[model samples]
Target chain A: MSQPSHSSVLPQTELTRHRRLREQGSFRRADLDAILDAGFVCHLGVIVEGRPLVVPTVYGRDERVLYVHGSVASRSMAGGTPVCVTVTQVDGLVLARSVFEHGVNYRSAVIHGTVRKVTDPDEKLEGLRRLTEHATPGQWSYARQPNRKELAATTLLALSLEEASVKIRTGAPDDGDGPDADLGVWAGTLPLTATWGAPEPDPLLPPDIPVPAHIARREGTRHG
Target chain B: MSQPSHSSVLPQTELTRHRRLREQGSFRRADLDAILDAGFVCHLGVIVEGRPLVVPTVYGRDERVLYVHGSVASRSMAGGTPVCVTVTQVDGLVLARSVFEHGVNYRSAVIHGTVRKVTDPDEKLEGLRRLTEHATPGQWSYARQPNRKELAATTLLALSLEEASVKIRTGAPDDGDGPDADLGVWAGTLPLTATWGAPEPDPLLPPDIPVPAHIARREGTRHG
Candidate 1:
């Protein structure tokens, strides 16, 4: 028998195994990267005082690591903590004939890792820059970079991308051939899209300054 | 001294307490309701085998309960499990003159509660109806409802909405008067909006079937 393809496949460990709906799970490393690249915001889950706490945080990722930033005073940004970060993008609604077959067309990636707080000055700055540029491309050079004092007050957590799971569902819903098909109810997919709108200048900003090329061009562009 | 308004405010519990970013926290019951109503998807954080697991799932909420459904075999949907569910809607990006001052304008709600599995057939059906309708109004009535066997294969977890926290950030970015303001780089808010696009009928659907009023009317309407 030919050897199973492992060149570009993500390693499946106990944490990354798909326990349910295995059909939706993807083992390709490219799938994980695509899911992470499509969104800049992720919900971070960490155990706080023996209970789970989910926080909505902004994130940026490189090929090897996912970077999340927060205020130094934030409780969840501590280093060496095991955390789960999930980024989800809703593509549309799967309008099946039956409620049981109805589902969401979405792409999501879940990452499991221990976060390491960046204390080194250079990596911290670079991590922060990636975080900024991830959310708004071309933003790092456009905005003022963080200074020592400003950087001191911020915490950057770097999570490895090795342990990750990707699940994507698209197209029409199930039940077209199922028993519910006899019901004759309408069935289809309703596409949902997030777009960036025109930039509203800061009220205090001087009118002479025009919207930047990077920011202005993003109008009507897809986000998440 | 006059008593602080307590009638409309959510009870402050240890889990709902906002330790950091006090300015973004809200105790108002109406705020929590509004945030929950604005989105149908939530990130559910649950402790699985001593490690935090975050899953992106669809959710629906009533005044006192938030319902989440999944296959009965799903591990995180087990009853008596303590879970944290967070719903977030990104409104805009705050482009500050300084990277340190940059932020996201968003509204989010975090809920902490023990999930109760719905066993009563009536309540289970009702919960499923709410879940369907939450994602698509009039969907429950228009689509074929679940039968007895289908309900048996599904799990519905009901979470109490009594303990929750709300945070909303809007408007222009900070740094208007900060040292970075003098840098003269442009700063503003780029609004992000999610809208429903035209429905695409299932390829297997009969050509005579037209998009229903309930689904077609939502085209071009703002979602989250």
Candidate 2:
């Protein structure tokens, strides 16, 4: 598969700089896109009434803009608020000979930006299409498009991906050459994999209707 | 399995109350413990210099206290700061006949509290043990424990689980009886499941060494 287009490197602001694990951090914009594309759900962090609130929401990305949608009355959907959108995929558990070295193998991206509401009618529809297609491919074209009333009820916020941080940790544990390696304990990585199981048809659907090809093909396929 | 001891229901504080989708919210303390116990990774949300930052980390819980550990120098690990820790598990994709109704079936917990540093040596040791066992059961006793020097390098914070918000969305899409049902489009849930694969041994390990029974038995087992 062709890689997503990311022409420039991610700009590291004072907030995006890695303070702890500098080696695991990356400035490559491609890494950010890969991390974002590998998952659909993200945790949105916003300050509400002077306290931080982290909410789980589904998101989509088109080039440099990441789109998140919610109800119009949702507090986190308020436009122009500074938000932190984080997407993480846990790949495995790194079993080490020492408890101190045990860690998770994962990839994560943190995007820090002020969210802008999509007020334009055309952009709003297109943003919604991206959001739907991001979660389930081919559904945007196969399903019924939104009407004016549905469009007005939803709130879509766009966040720039320019200021983002990507960190990835993989491979075996770091204690292979340490003192714990001599302890005769088993040490390796127990990989974790997620896959799509058989699609369960809606109980209320007519028995004559069959599952769509787009949805059927995803069965047994790997997910982030 | 016996349920964890929870004395009372979670207090519905001003912050924990669900402003939107109130029907999906729950104040039951048992629900909070179940959500926390099912996952090991969480997104830590904190304000650093007035900007919201979300970091992914591992956590453990002991009755009313949830412990999270990180490097002492990590900026987001600062003690005594008001923080939000969120744990989410995506069960499936809720595919609807209408693009407007597309949603994800998930269970998530948002914890809001001021984190206190575990300064006492005995408590610190116990906290670390809980964290280790939480992530990898049976490994705590199999592997070498952290030394005093290692403990000094780590920073552990305890957050009370008294104030938390639990929201769960499950089953099929809500548009089964709506107008979109006449469109002859597929509508159902594509279940997602994570499982543990075979353990990969370190390349430099002795050939005679075998995978431990605890880790070996977990292969092919389902994960949250």
lDDT of 2 at A175: 91
DockQ of 2: 0.75
Q: Candidate 2 chain B: minimum summed lDDT over ten consecutive residues — where?
A: B70-79
Against the reference, the lDDT scores of all candidates come to 0.86, 0.85
Query: Where does candidate 2 stray beyond 4 Å?
Result: A1-6, A71-77, B1-6, B71-78
lDDT of 2 by residue, B62-127 (tens): 988899876312455556788889999899999888888888888999999998889888999999
lDDT of 1 by residue, A14-106 (tens): 988888878899988888888888887899888988888898989887778899876322475467788999999999899999888889999
Cα-lDDT of candidate 2: 0.85
In model 1, where do residues sit more than 4 Å from their true spots? A1-7, A71-78, B1-7, B71-77
Question: CAPRI band of model 1?
Answer: medium
Residue B33 lDDT (model 1): 86
**Candidate 2 docking class:** medium
